[model samples]
Target chain A: MDYKINVEGQTARIKLGGRLTFSHHREYRDVLNQLMSHKAQIYEFDLSGVDFIDSAGLGMLLIAKQHAEASSAEVVLKKPAEEVQRMLKVAKFEKMFNIIQ
Target chain B: MGVLANDVQLEKNQGLDSIKVKGLHNNIFVNRESVEKSESDIKNSYILVVDDLEMNRKVLGKHLTKAGFDNIEFAENGEIALQKVAESNFDILLLDIMMPGIDGFEVCQRLRSQSCYKSLPILVQTALDGDDDRSQAFAAGATDVISKPINGPELIARLHIHLENKFLVNRLTQYHDRLADELEVVQQLQQDLVPNEEQIAAIQKNLSLRLSAHFQPSSEVGGDLWAAHELSDGRLSVFLCDLTGHGVVAAVNAFRLHVLIDTLEEYILDPGCFLTELNKRLVALLPVGTFATAFHAIIDPRTEKITYAAAATHTVQIMSAENMQINILEGDGVPLGILANETYETIQIPFPYGSSLLCYSDALVEVSDSQNRNISNQTVKEWFHEAKLKKVDVVEYILNALTSCGITWLADDLTIVSVSNETE
Candidate 1:
């Protein structure tokens, strides 16, 4: 998996591509570090390019959200693929993040 | 001069000059004795001398020969040295710095980069005595250094030390690899001991109960085990056990339990007796600081009742199909292998047609949430209640819920066994 980060004003947008599973742990941690370093008020993870995600990947997303919230920042998930959207809905992630179509 | 003339004639005519022949014989005998005396010291250790100057090579060769090292090869530059190293295994390398094309340091670094040569000793020999040069050689992976006009005693001492250490490391590596391969075979044997799909199906068919189970080990092998047997009185005896630890030790314990239960087929109908006997055996067999939590139950289709005993702290949930009511059977006694005289109590519950019983290891309730804290048992109970209302497979529903809640890998071994009386 790979990620590209863009920051504008107080918002940081991280675009993720490829499979988001346990194998991408290091890359995900690096993205999280980048997000924390920016201290952005709003963080958006664009998951349209994500083709697959396992339970570990979902757990990591939750960790990222928790970290952002602890820093008084808001996190939103945007443009998830169809399968990713179904899994998020099944896991009831809407209770945690502001998911956008 | 007659002897010299006679020696030439001897070579042509196969005739001998006695005095000259005796001298030749003495020389051959002396040479053989010397070679035999040094053979053990050398042991055919191949040493490479990398020097651009032929004179330096000859000097080192003579010193090594005097030290009983007969097997030596020469490489004029670092490039040639690397090529020679790749071609065959050399016990030690005597490298010279300041050579044309690919210096000694670069050769050492490149050799170190390859895993095969990672442990090969490269002794740097140089005339330059700068601190920077020494540090650079060390940084580039030179094992040891011999400074200018090499000291014969120091060179021999360093070579002996490095060669011994290298051989020791190689032997250790071989032992480690062999041990790993053996462990893999043990792991496979343990995994094969678990009930396969065909065995589960046969048990389900014989017992007239819908059975579903999920077993996931935290490692290659785990302590979690579940088994079902058809009792003599036509009841289904099912049990789930979880040992205190994971991996090989736990797997061995699981195997022992499996064999023990299979041997105690007569006690299956009485849950209390079965658990008592099992606990007694475990207390005697299990090592200190190790114990097991288990739930054993007998399902009698004719009597429409379930007799069960628990030696764990985890609650067993039963969902009644008649009214969709969930009943939690609280565990009452200490885990097995803890108190030898502790007797377990058997609880009887209505196992009417269409009722389902869920038995699981603590791994189910011990799953961590997003904040890394364990998800409460209350939350798990609520999910079970919801699953019961939905009329879903209780085991599948609980495992799926846990997975959806971000529990991909369990910290402990997980074993969930669900038995439902579907006969209407």
Candidate 2:
């Protein structure tokens, strides 16, 4: 997926596109590591353009949230696709993160 | 020398001086193409080409060489391809779906089922163009399918895809094997913590001891553990316990049990109190669905005394010297994980010198024949009676007896610890 990082109002947003699967683990971890340098008050993830999200992608997301929480930052999910929304609900992860559907 | 080669020489002369030189250059390029094509037709790789027609094999071999693949092999029918795959590793298989003696689909399935070539990639180059054909290829484990009367570029592309995938899968298997090896090393290290039977014998002064172990893992690692520890008061502590379930998690619990016992030896001296404390700590730390059934006994050979306790384990047997007297040692309490702050009372038995205590995991008593008939315990008792009360090699004797009863596969981890009194 295409990954873009933007900073707005003390929140670091990671914009994603296309499929997120096993191949994206390294890139996803790299993105999280880069965001940690700024000491942002809030970390936002954009899944609006994501066409698919598999088990490995979900694991990456969970690890990213854990790392962000360790640094005293709040993680929020923004503008997820319909499929992404369904997966989050089924896995009961909606209650753990900010899901903007 | 040949006519075609000489015609190219005249083309070099007839053109207007310099203009003819450029045209001759173009003709040379054309001539070079045929020569290069012939060179490619001879390159070598093990390829199994299956086609009903003989001419099809010749044409396909010619084209395959042009694509830089040589060492071509031929099989007219699907059965031959399967036989060849069973014998050797063929790099690429060019299969025709419509063949006699087991069609391409069946051949693919049989090849996959063979012990040797299960991972060999098969490409279906067939005239058949239907979802049914595609599904059949997939069901039979064919890596890819290409349409017949193949476009050269498309054939090359499909070949490349399947070969690359096969290479990746083989590399992955190698990595998995290396990981399994490392895990085995770790498991052995964990197993080494338990003392062998000889070490247990050295600690006991009066009682004759025999320790036998059976570990039949449902997975790579087992959860059961047995240890013989020399306590501070000079008594030997013999412990046999089965942690819940099997595999890595259970093995981890067994390690924890070892550490807990080591720590308990330093602080708690009483067998009853030590086990009770161990039960409380384990229940608090272990995840749900994890618990242990254990029998722990402290034997003092000099005094001909043994203090014993059991937690959800079978009644232990104290065998007399004559092989006629057998006393059962039973303890009333729930298994270790069921209760906290639970007090256990120790039973003191006057174990005479030269007599032996037979303590074991449930595997010994739980053994059954092929038809699920109980044989382990009854056979052990009978074997002891027939052996003439001789002190055979302790560990070997127990293992030999267990094996003779047709009890080779212990369902759970099996361990027996025997201590002989040498003080008298």
Candidate 3:
């Protein structure tokens, strides 16, 4: 798994690639730390490259959302692949984050 | 005439005395105090010297012998060197680079091509001092290089270092093999902790219940566990537990819970008390970061009631055979081992004849399809309703449906248990 971060003004765009599961906890934590340190007003996660996710992956996203909210920032999930979008819908993630096509 | 014979005999005596003196010098070289400590090491190690010239081979052999290395072999050329290596095991190889048929560099490269000789140390002895020759030797997999006029002490030190490393590698390989064997045994033992088919059948027969279950681990061992015990008072106690993670650590926790439940058989009638006591034991025994989610229930056939308590977030559903309706029971308590003083609550419901109660781990709801959409609880309830309408075993029906829908691999350990009252 890999991530590319692009920061412009107060918005940070993170593009995640590869499978998002329990095994990617360390990498996800590192990305989370980077997001917190940047203190971006808006955080956008680009899931276009992600192919698969599991229950633990949903839990990780929830944790990330909580962290963003605690820091007074808003998070949006953008451009998810078809499969990723379905997983998001199944987990009812739309109620938690601002999901844009 | 007598004086002449005496002088000839004196000359012969002097010749014998000179030979004895040379023998004494060789003995002194072999028995030196400085090399006494390494005598056993050198004797145990086998050294191979490959050189085309007979005189050079003799000189190298003599030096090695004097340094207390009694086991030495000679290879006149590269071809013979390869043959000897294949036939016997040598701790270190001393190869002379310049040979007629096959050069030392070619020999080293060929030996390194074989997996068994990948870590074998090949010391190159070259007469040429050019940088090109040294680099070429290294590129051909030479471990270290020595100049033509070999210094005895330097050779001995290099041999000792390489042999020590080889011995260490051998020891580590042995330890790895032993550990793998032990883990295999442990894996089998962990599988044995679950209730076998015969035990499940006997429980069903004795308690007048129709029980069916399915269990699969992502690896050799798993954290999911289920057991059904028939109480003496015509009651049945059933429980399923899923630890935080999977594999050996989770399997060990499952074994602990199995033993703990056996010890607490007296409290099996009260769901709330059993769960509370289980939480207390888990909080004391489990590590800080580990916890278990569980569902424990007691069914009384005479009263037709089920009392259950859960320490997880998964919903347990009871499908009514009367109206083909599904009633969901939500588990709202915290997972076990998380808090020291947390209490659990139990809910009682009527287990009417022909009604089935379904219990499953999170892996069931988390199962995804080809499009990565998870199987929602509503879909599962619908399947249960269909199974009830068809009068089939609900657990087997759901599993077969999932398999037919391309949901083969589960990301985590999965266990599903269903108990239905067969008495109508």
Q: Write the per-residue lDDT of candidate 2 for residues B1-424, one digit (tens) a residue.
A: 2122212222222232321111111332223333333234324336788887798888787878887886778988877777777677687798888887688888888778876767676888788889998888888878777778876666654564455445444555787999899779757866686765466546544233333334344356677787776665566777877776556777788888888887776534466777788898887876533567778887776677888777755536676754456655564455676456666667788766666677666556555655666654445555544442564644457677666666677655666655554442
Candidate 2: stretches off by over 4 Å: A1-101, B1-118, B122-147, B151-172, B201-218, B232-234, B376-379, B384-390, B393-395, B422-424
Candidate 3, residues B1-424: lDDT per residue as tens digits? Answer: 1111211111113223221101100211212222333335546888899999999999889888887887889999999999999999988898999999999999999999999899888888899889999989999999877777887666665665455455545656776888778778877787677777888888887887888888876666777888888887668888988776677777788888888988887778888888899999998988644667788999877788899988754647897768868987767566676567878888898988778899888778767787777797777888888888888888899898888779988867888888887752
Residue B336 lDDT (model 2) = 71
- Model 1 TM-score on a 0 to 1 scale: 0.64
CA displacement after TM-score superposition, residue B104 of candidate 1 (Å) = 1.7
TM score of chain A per candidate: 0.96, 0.92, 0.95
The CA lDDT at B270 in model 3 is 87
Best by DockQ: 3
Better of 2 and 3 by DockQ: 3
DockQ of 2: 0.03
Off by over 4 Å in 1: A1-101, B1-45, B62-70, B113-115, B205-207, B232-234, B301-303, B322-325, B382-411
Candidate 3: regions farther than 4 A off: A1-101, B1-45, B55-71, B92-169, B216-219, B300-304, B323-328, B364-372, B375-411
- Ordered by TM-score, highest first, the candidates read 1, 3, 2
Residue-level lDDT tens digits of model 1 in B1-424: 2222211211112243221112211211123322333334345679999999999999999989987888999999988998999998898899998898999999999999999888788889999799999989999999877788987776775665555455545556787899788878876776666677787787777776777887877776788888877775558888888776677778888889888887777777788888888889888997643567788898987788999988754547787878867777766555677557767788898898878888777667656776676665567677878876787777788888887888888766788778888731
* Residue B84 in model 1: lDDT: 93
